[model samples]
Target: MTTERRVLVYGANGYTGKIVSESLANRGIPHYFAGRNREKLEAALSIVAERFGSPVDAEIAVASNNPDELRPLFAKVDVVINVAGPFMQMAWPVVETALECGCHYTDTTGEQDWSRAIAEQYGQAFADKGLLLAPATSYMWSAGALAAEIVLENKGVDSLDIIYQIDRGLPSEASTKSFLRMVCNDQLYLDLNEYAAWDWDTLVDVHVPYRGASIRAFPWGGACEPIWYKDDPRVLNCKVLTAMGEHLIDGVKMAIDKFHEEALSLSQEEREAWTNTVGDTMHQGEPPKDNVTAQRSCIIVGGQGQTTTVQYVMNLSAPYTWTGEVSAEAAKQLLAGKLLKPGFQSVATAFNHRELLQTFHELGFTSAPPAPGTL
Candidate 1:
């Protein structure tokens, strides 16, 4: 149990992992790019060196459900920033190992089930050990949570409605797999401190603050917010809805529903195999140059109470770039001994909103005041 300022980026060969590695390298942070394949790790290290003008380090470590194989790797680093997914299949090994090694852990998981499992099952264990186990530390949920927190800072709001949107971006292979897994999970929402199941087919048209147009969105388990605010007495309800480029109105919903229904009929192994097949075919191996440069993400959070209301909207460019920056920053915070409390924490609870906003601002994200007639 050595207290050292070092990090290990697992699954460093993945698209988001490469970006995170580059971010850490640009910041001159000491880290190891680790994955199962030696060749991929070497290639990722080369890319990091070529892009950042310097090389960090590299390791080949396979994450297994068995903690024995992962404990040694965890012992070598003070913090582990896991960018791997289908987190439902992979997160347990890395997380369990980190806890065993008494190391801080964070991941870029957006799966509500996975996030909730960590928070409810492992949160107390991590807290008992005084080690942070923050998941969903990426743009998927963190961006929205940060925006919601900003509104809740002073205002006494009890319920929230969040809409998330992204433009001109393609999903990476890992992202596609994670999403497929997400679609198969149960949909839920928070209602006055109780968890209630929601129908996935239900869609509503909402105004996207960033796009300045109305689009159809579906309930997305109120991602991370309900879980984050679950025990807080101030919040009574939270609902998160998400949409992307006409997907809901188009055939995407039908396709997703079909897939979900079919997946429900398969065994765990069969479902996993199907997921890999789809991910391999549909996953964007590398985003188009234009997409990476021109993509943007937006989140609108409206918190309403009986008598008062607050709203916040955040627009960020280059979603993957921002994910890398945020994940790298969280790793840095952990390595610097800044995480005082340990538990399954949201990004907003683990990090300062003002500082996060400053980072977003530095990275060219824009925030606007509440929309007209918000209250």
Candidate 2:
């Protein structure tokens, strides 16, 4: 609520975090860069400065989720864009501190369970405090949700089938870890406006409009669009399915089966711990940089009603860059007091969807033909 609207980018040293930092820097927004590693944060600061050709007039803070350590830092910022991942494992302390310090919180999380948890456990608290808790504001989930919302604007479109297909790019270390942890169990989707378990074993065959071919995809730990629209009177059924290459999907299925077999006897809590340990060994290195073509993605959202069925196809490149752009922009919106509501919200709900989509177009993420309904 301060006039200056100070900002903080938590996890500002990680892969996607650095991208978020870069976006913020590109906007010429002065903010603090914070993470557990001061050395990495310092390195990220240098990168941002070098890229922008201007010294970012910002301080760097070293802190973890420990409230005593985080409170002072959180107090100094009006908004926190948390890019740290595997949110189910590491998000609580940061969330608690953000709430305690009266800061608006947003993160790049596609984990449906965690988003639902935020809504169920702390949605009212955030609303009561008149603070915003907008999770899953990144490319994975939010991008599709925004497209779904756009289609929903057409009258009588209620049921949404959201599918995300990334044609390229290697998953970052953090993303690989999160995916492994998420795919360890079944996910939830909306049926008759109620949450129902989606079997981890099932892979749905999704037709990619751009590719003009059907590919195997699954609700990779479920999509949060259903959760986001759970209370909306407009939606009755929602399911989200996603896939990379067919080979990658096959590998993921194999990993899921393997994990289930190995962790069959372990408690859910124990499985959570197990996934973390297993994820650490899977991918550990820097992701490819400035590879927009390799990071291309497509979103297919079809809305079905009693008699009408309309599908929208959007193609975009550079998923990670889009994440950074959107997250940084969301932080600015929060700082400017531009929010839809206080409680747990998606990017579409938190901002004007038309404006948001226009931003997407302005970012050069949107492409032509098939347009909206031609497909």
Candidate 3:
């Protein structure tokens, strides 16, 4: 086995993959791009080589969504960063093969069902397979969650809430498609108990801001609401919300929600309904001419600590970007024989967080605002 800490980037054809690879290259980190499509591989590499103005040197391998080819791909690499998402649908084969090959797994998975499924279903298997499966380590959970954890360390963080809002730049046609494909995955709307719970009639609502525009947001998906809160004994209840709240955007997310629920039970009609709805949302971004700006995301973690203290909002960019780098950086550290822990774990449990934050500060990426309530 070559001692080169080989990193394999799946879905190297997607929008975020391009940036992720660029980020890796900008830092002079070596990684291989693997995907099911050959054309995409060639195109992606062409761009990477051109933009970086450096040697075009990355082993791009094409696996035809075939299990046989994927297995060997894993054995050759130490870490696999999966970007091809809508993971609840496209996750299995690659994930299964990666574990079977005795390689560690990590991905930008934001799907709640995907995360819980991997944990409840394959959590032990990954451990038994002697592999570490880290999911939702991207902009969603990693950056914001870690920052939130940092604030709560000694100050006492009993309940945590993470909200992400990134607008201003409209994604390319391809980018928008990938985003839609991701949101089209099965939605696992559950109560605070980790059991099956999806109640739209009653929701956890809060007034937040977007581009200085105050908006009312209700509970959305992904992170466990009450459970995420309840896990930390101090939190009696916790819920999640997003920029595009269900009530706020009636057509897009509402239809997608029904589709995800129906997808589990194999409902074709519901699936079509979701496809159409997403298509509608897609149509709105065809030309990107209007300078589509995004709203700012804020996470208000409210709990009884010095009387309902709320510090930094998790959805802020600088913190999100910083935390995001934490995931891959941490994985790189782990592969280098640094971080090691088995079973299901959030970003907070990943490393000596102070060092992690220091890495971000050193890079001069994103940062928190000034001290609050300090005269």
Q: What does candidate 1's lDDT look like per residue over 1-375, in tens digits?
A: 223437888888888888888887666676767777778778777877787776555444555445776787789887889988888788788898888898888898878888898887789999999888888888878887888777676466889788887775567778777766665557667899888777766677888753567877766444777777787777789888877556323444664676677777888878877767766766546764223346766788888988787777777767777788888888777766777467888767776666767766865755543333443
Model 2 residue 109 lDDT score: 85
TM-score for each predicted model, relative to the true structure:
0.90, 0.94, 0.76
Q: Arrange candidates, best lDDT first.
A: 2, 1, 3
Compared with the true structure, what per-residue lDDT tens digits does model 3 show for residues 1-375? 233647788887665565556556655567777788889888977776776687544678888555798877888887787877666667788778877777777877655656777777777887775567777767555655555555565344455554544444333444343344445543333234344444432233345543445544433444533322234444433445555433335544554565556554556446544554565665544332221123333555433354455555433443323333654575567666765565455545546555665665566544443243421
| Ordered list by TM-score, greatest first | 2, 1, 3
State the weakest 10-residue window (summed lDDT) of model 1: 366-375
Residue 340 of candidate 2: its Cα lDDT?
Answer: 81
List residue ranges in candidate 3 displaced over 4 A: 1-5, 169-198, 201-205, 208-213, 224-236, 244-273, 276-299, 305-310, 314-327, 368-375
lDDT (Cα, tens digit) per residue for candidate 2, span 297-325: 88889999887888888786788888888
Query: Which of the two candidates, 2 or 3, achieves a greater TM-score against the reference?
Result: 2
Best lDDT goes to which candidate?
Answer: 2
TM-score winner between 1 and 3, please give it. Answer: 1
Instruction: Give residue 273's lDDT in candidate 3 (0 to 100).
Output: 48
Model 1: residues with Cα > 4 Å off, grouped in runs: 1-5, 57-66, 210-212, 220-222, 247-251, 267-269, 288-293, 366-375
Colliding pairs, model 3: 143-323, 167-294, 168-293, 168-294, 190-197, 191-197, 225-238, 318-366
What is residue 37's positional error in candidate 2, in angstroms?
1.6
Candidate 1 backbone clash number: 0
Single out the weakest 10-residue window by summed lDDT for candidate 3: 286-295
Best candidate (score: TM-score): 2
